[model samples]
Target: MAGLDFEPALAAALTRHVQGITSVGKLTRLSGGASQETFAFDAHTASGTLPLILRRAPGGSRDGGSGQGTALATEARAITAARACGVKAPEVVYVLTPQDGVGDGYVMERVEGETLARKILRDKEFDAVRPKLAYQCGQAMAQIHQADASQVPELRLVTGPQQLAEYYERYRAYDLPKPVFEMAFAWLKPRIKEPKRTVMVHGDFRHGNIMISPKTGLAAVLDWEIVHRGDPLEDLSWICINAWRFGVTGKVVGGFGDVPEMLAGYRDAGGDAYTVEDVRTWEVMGSLKWGIMCMGMYEVFRTGYDRSVERAAIGRRSSENEIDLVNLLIG
Candidate 1:
């Protein structure tokens, strides 16, 4: 029931929200999300039939050490803040809080777009659209950074140095003897002196995290679990990281465009204070951070906190991509 039991409650909730709404049916879980559960459903309402998405933390049981609560709240707040800032985020219909006895979840409009990285990079239908997406990604990120932080106080959850420190602590807590990652950690400590500027960073900004339409290019930026305050360049570098290039490594900037175009777009969109050096440094950090985090996800799967074959596979991907970081630093 925990996995697919939300149907009855969801139907009741929908009925209350939409007058004369009734007969909600065909709720099914969607794939691709390992940290949380997502479902798409159709509902019969007096207004009309509707398609919606429901996102909630994985089950209702909160593992003592997994930082799931903060993550859930962070994503909900990010969706709200992004919409208020004029960013292209899915419209949030309702935020289910803990007190609601519905677990932590949210209902939103199901946006139509493709989130597959390779598909976006290879699809001929997006030939014209893809070229301009990098710049648009930059512009959208700039807008998110410019969002009033006060509206989303959760952005202050971590700062520059604390951000890196927290990741190290998480890895250490796992007690995994990762020599390469240890070296990367040592390299990151000194580099964390101070950022040139502080802004909201979409912690996991990259090609796969964005949804793009074959015709319109970037439709909306997804995955807000890691949203926090830090160097604006962190977001830029993250998108350009090689792992996200999806076989188009030579293109550099998310395989959609070049760095100059991305930087130029960000600069024109009021990110003038950002510098190339700043973004480069963060790019290195981005690679290391994601590599380590990928390992953490695998740990979660292995430890039975979450048992998903997809997560185990993702964990194995960290090593190959971390090497890219080593090369970037030494070469």
Candidate 2:
């Protein structure tokens, strides 16, 4: 609040567009992400004080995060697509452009739910729904995968082969040697088939991105920056990736349940038919994909892009993905 460069601009934008908002109060800079900055505040409106969250790309451009640094409007439009398919997505209230003087970003209605991955996995308060969380995730994913993405023109439709090749190229540029990643890539290249069942995928639909309720289980899916048209099985397998298991390796699906329960939920929710082999392939691919990203992040740290302890530590996580890739591909 004391020295933030965007505070005055933010106030101006809110005053101009945010209707009936007497003022914004208790504004807090939540997270300083490289691609976008997130903030939470209360809008003192005429009716009532509404809680809201803002996602803004610092300095008017994206940097230091997932995807090719997609624009905030793309994410907002993707969320709208997901919600149209009955997925519980947060409603976007306003999108801020450069003309608004707040940079590029969007404001969303603050939802009431818990997003902590570990707490959802182990906390006793979630005991009733923890066992059912995996299936719930499957049902939610089915809705997302079935969502008509063609409605959102801003989204880029991509195929598996395209992204996989890009990942390999990115990894090579790092000049870091990873045998497991190499072998996994070698195994995946030929197996990559034309996606038989394509849908709009929630690219990063892991535990942390999901919002859960103690009474109802899955509440909403957050983070749409990387969403694109791809194999729906990729979404299914990405959730099952061991890296997102949060230390409880026994329960493969985000430390909550197994494949059968999730598949059953998917079927109940009308997701397209897919094979176990296809899912296994994507699961392995997800591990490799994450490993490549982890190593890439390490390079970012090594190069002093952000130079935080967290960024430096993320590279070490590549080993976890490597181990997972070995178990999936070789075993």
Candidate 3:
């Protein structure tokens, strides 16, 4: 799988399954996404060269991660369903089969945009698009939520209380005490409630998972690995988590726009009515969720399960989420 050696197997798959794909060119694995592997390459088709991305499990395993995510095929189906609902999700070109020999993953159109949270927030190039991203995110979430459940992949049904308990249990197992996490947990426990109706919730609908186009604002929503059926407010509140706002905490929505505007866009796009207070509750949960995730990641580092510096660095950010929880729950 070094250099261009990975091309032949992938090329064979694409040529056999993907229409017009004659061969592949320069398949390069992209960095980041620890749980999954991503590769960028060109499909030298009969008509033109096409840029596409292959996302798969780390070692071609059918089920990636420790039961944290759905199958790659399921993720691909969710993307297709989202796109069908008018959400700006990547177009799924092909789902890799075991016979393909590439891995357990799918091929999607390479969306052109910035996915880095800090770069999209601070870069001068994205300055013009910053102000509108939150609203666009709202619109996209609305479309995703409106998708027919029957049409999309079978997703796990997750409730707010269910998630809170799961994360809290994980935190307890870690045995690393944080007063902020404790306080956030106590504050969130009583408030967490299931919605009257459920919709497709993009479990991690934050800055990094969203693609931003300088000219068009929000491009496509990426990473549906943990997507599930839940309250739409979960998606709404997740973007408002202070950690996603980066250093620009004032904007309150992905470091770009205000909550009112985000809500306006959501409601305008046929999303259910939700108050700012509603979003605030879920925001608290989202902060607590992220804090626990950071802790779990740090646990990996602590146990030498993953000795990567990245794991340790992300573990250090748990305190940041603590501050966010304090601001939301205590302030």
TM for every model, in the order presented, reads 0.86, 0.92, 0.95
* lDDT per residue as tens, model 1, 1-331: 3477767877777666655668678888885354677788877767787787777777744322145334565667777887777788887776665544556777777888988888888888888798898789888888888877776775554555776888888888878788777877788788765666677777777866799998888898876766777777778888888888877878888887888888887877777555666667777777877888798889889889888788899998988766887787777
- The best candidate by lDDT is 3
Error of 1 at 48 (Å): 3.0
lDDT of 3 by residue, 1-331 (tens): 6544657888899999988999888788885365688889999977899999988887566654357787778788878888888998889999999888877889999989898988998889998888888788888889999988776647888888888888888999999889988988888888888787888888888887898888989998998988889888889999898888888989999889998889988988988878889899889988888889899889989999899999999998998888888888778
The residue pairs found clashing in candidate 3 are none
- Give the per-residue Cα lDDT of candidate 3 at 95: 94
Better of 1 and 2 by lDDT: 2
Worst 10 residues of 3 by lDDT: 59-68
Each prediction's whole-model lDDT (CA)? 0.76, 0.82, 0.85
Clash pairs detected, candidate 2: none
Error of 3 at 49 (Å): 0.7
Alpha-carbon runs more than 4 Å astray in model 2? 2-12, 15-20, 59-67
- Rank order by lDDT, top first? 3, 2, 1
Deviating ranges (above 4 Å) for candidate 3: 1-4, 32-34, 64-66
lDDT of 2 by residue, 151-224 (tens): 76656667778878989999999998788899998999998777887788888888878999999998889887
